[model samples]
Target: MTGPHALKPFLLAFPGPLRDRLVAAVLSGEKTATTGLLLEYEAEKEELPEVGERSALIDSDGREVAVVEITEVQVLPLRDADLRLALAEGEGYRSVAEWRAGHENFWHGEEMREALGDPGFVVDGDTMLVVEWFRVVEVLREA
Candidate 1:
């Protein structure tokens, strides 16, 4: 217990308010799913999460607040992103339009742009997404 935890870090977003909200959602069971651009995994050379895989949910302050187990993972296009998935994110999007609108804002944010090394990067219908669903297994800490 003196060193870093063994599980890989499962981060929802950047380290700030956005991530804080996301962590809260996960911890409270309001959020059970998340979507990420396939481009991000490609850029980082990361593999897709498999069913039953476990990870440490790292919060904005670098604390492992919980352990999450992946239940499902789907790779689909932006056009295929559905309301069910959106609703599971627990951000209170009532429609697909609302979800896409919110996601577009984040996908086009400066931090994401910088991470992708493209200031003008934009998401489109053809854009691929890695939609993952997970359940919190254990909560290690609180906010």
Candidate 2:
């Protein structure tokens, strides 16, 4: 899956079931956006994707599923994420509170806590997040 001629690769956003469900959502045109760590993950890796960048969406197994173009990129605090952003997330969250609750759980999960080496990791208004809006440019059908 890694070669000059191979399709470009981008993370599937989440892991396991969440990733699968979200990918399916994107394919079905229900999801148009995603969010991720701006500092700890992107900046740390020096791989912050820019607006207008196109990427091959990959599954948990590292298989390319689709290609998407980033339409918008917003660096904002977790507290600044409003219902508009949640709606763009395409998760059917009715309100920002609901979205925040769900994301707080994800960010505080055992895996993330261990990865960040901060068991007390918490999502606050100041927590920076890279919210990316995307559109599916092409769906790579399995061969």
lDDT of every predicted structure (CA atoms): 0.93, 0.79
TM-score of each: 0.96, 0.88
- Off-target runs (Cα >4 Å) in candidate 1 are 1-5
Off by over 4 Å in 2: 5-8
Candidate 1 residues 64-135, lDDT tens each? 899999999999999998889989998988999999999999999999999999999999999999999999
Tens digit of lDDT per residue, candidate 2, span 11-115?
A: 654568888878888888888888876756653575667888888888877678888899988889887898888887778899999988878888888877777
Cα lDDT of candidate 1 equals 0.93
Top lDDT hit: 1
Q: Pick the candidate with the highest TM-score.
A: 1
